[model samples]
Target: MDVVQQRFAEWVYKLGITLTERQAEQFETYFRLLVEWNEKMNLTGITEREPVYEKHFYDSLTIAEAVDFNKTSSIADIGSGAGFPSLPLKIAFPHLKVTIVDALAKRIRFLDEVIAALGLDNVTALHGRAEEVARDAIHRDHYDVVTARAVARLSVLNEFCLPFTKSGGVFIAMKGTDVEEELRDSGYSAHVLKGEAREVLKLKLPLEQSERHLVIIDKKGSTPKAYPRKAGTPLKSPLVDPAASQ
Candidate 1:
């Protein structure tokens, strides 16, 4: 095994994920494709071997700290730029049923290429706005977990993600550590969208040691029909707990 795979295995191993030799090869293949395709179009700014392994690949797996993929079966990733957290999670678990939604068709194309090249199964890439896609019955309230990474604020992200989370399931917002203000601001969005806020979980990236966070919100019930507003409303006018101004 090469140094990248060796170090990646050691890191995720601490998270209770043991990588088979094939899994290691799959990650190597994924890394090559990421750099190759990125040259053609905008996929990710971080494309170097070690940083991709550390920030993109390993950073994605840190969700394992907040979630038990062994117990979870399905996940939906919203505005999944470069498929952080989901693609890596799929590579690690292999059993996960992953649905990735992105508004940009080009990114969807990249994800499809990666899935096909990696020989991954049970993964679907859809091209559409998150708001409209979440309205589909098959996607609505149907995932074991829903995730968004650096997509939007907690308030705006709730509208983008919570609609896809199954009742009793969880929506995990992957973010940088400065989320305290966002958590306070997102309370109304959660309440309006039928999610109960959970404490933000934190973990640091290896080597870089920069703190990352997972903002967890448990789905209390089905998304109210009025929710999510329209395609762009959630971004333009996110719900805020009016009482917070008091």
Candidate 2:
């Protein structure tokens, strides 16, 4: 193995994650494709071998710390820019059924290509506004777990993600920092959306030592139909405060 692979393997091993030879190969292939496609369009700014291995690949797998993948079968990643946690998690746990939703067609195309190249089964990429997608009968309240990786604020993110999680499922929002303020701002929105803050997990990235927070929200009840609003409404006017009318 090369330096990047060696570091990734070590990191995973240190974290008590088992990395089989095949899974390592898949990650290597994914890194190669990410760099190759990034040259064509804006796939990611962090394309260097080490950073990709550390920040993108390893960072994505950090979600496993919040929940046991063995118990979680289905996952939906909203605004899956560069397919962070979802794709990496899917690669690590081959049994997962992953659905990635993104607004940009180009990103979806990249995800599709990556899925096909990796020969990954039970993974689907959807191109559309997350708000509209979540409102659809097929997607609404259907996933075992829904995730958004630093997509937006907790309030906006709750609308984007909570609508898709099945009752009793969880929405895991990946954030960089300021998790406390986000949770305070998002509590009302979560309540409005029929979700409750379940847990908040903090961990530092192995190499960079950057702070990461996984805000886990349980979908205790059905989301109000008004949610997600329209395509761009949630971002423009999120439910930051329950009293504020949208």
Candidate 3:
């Protein structure tokens, strides 16, 4: 393995994740594909080799620190723009079954190309808003774990992601440091969506030292059919703690 690849493997190795030579090659191929397609579309601003490895690739793999992939069967990534945690997790744990949901068709095409180039299996890239797609029985409450990056606030994420989480499953939200206020604001939504706040796993990027938090919310029951409201509703009208307004 080259220096960049070796460093990445070592970082995850500390997390108890073992990467074989093939997986390392797949990650390298993914990096090349990401930089290549990024020229045509606005895939990601963080395209440099090492930075991509630290921020996107390693950051995605950190989910393993919170939940064990060996025990988890399926994961649905909601609003997986450019396929963050799900794609990398699938690469590391070949046994995982991954479903990536994103609203943009162009990004979906890019993800499809990456999956093909990587020669990955059991991965599906769907183009649609998370709200509508989670309503489908095939996807709704079907995954063992649901993931979303800091794409939206906690309350909004709860609405968009909880529907895709099966009962007794967990929705893991990857967020930055400003989580205290978000947790306070998200109480009602979590309760309403049949989700309970669990724990947050804190860690830092190997090189950058930027703090990242994994907000783990346990799904107690199936999402109410009324949840997710509409494709654009959650973001515009995020649920807030009633007491805060009072």
Q: How many residue pairs clash in each candidate?
A: 0, 0, 0
Q: Candidate 3, residue 44: CA error in Å?
A: 1.1
State the local distance difference test value for candidate 2: 0.89
lDDT of 2 by residue, 3-83 (tens): 778788888776557888888888988999999999989988897889899888898888888788899899999999899
Across 43-141, the per-residue lDDT of candidate 3 in tens digits comes to: 889998999999999999999998988999899998898889899999999989999999999999999999999999999999999989988999988
Off by over 4 Å in 3: none
Q: Cα lDDT of all candidates, in order?
A: 0.91, 0.89, 0.92
Q: Estimate each model's TM-score.
A: 0.98, 0.96, 0.98
Q: Write the per-residue lDDT of candidate 1 for residues 1-246, one digit (tens) a residue.
A: 888789989999998899999889888888998899899899889888998999998999988988889999999999997888899999999999999999998888899999998999999999999999988999999999999999988999999999999999999999997898998889889999999888788889998999999888999999999977889998888898777667
What residue pairs are clashing in model 2?
none
| Model 2 stretches astray by more than 4 angstroms | 242-246
Stronger candidate by lDDT (1 vs 2)? 1
lDDT for predicted candidate 1 compared with the true structure? 0.91
Cα RMSD to native, each candidate? 1.0, 1.7, 0.9
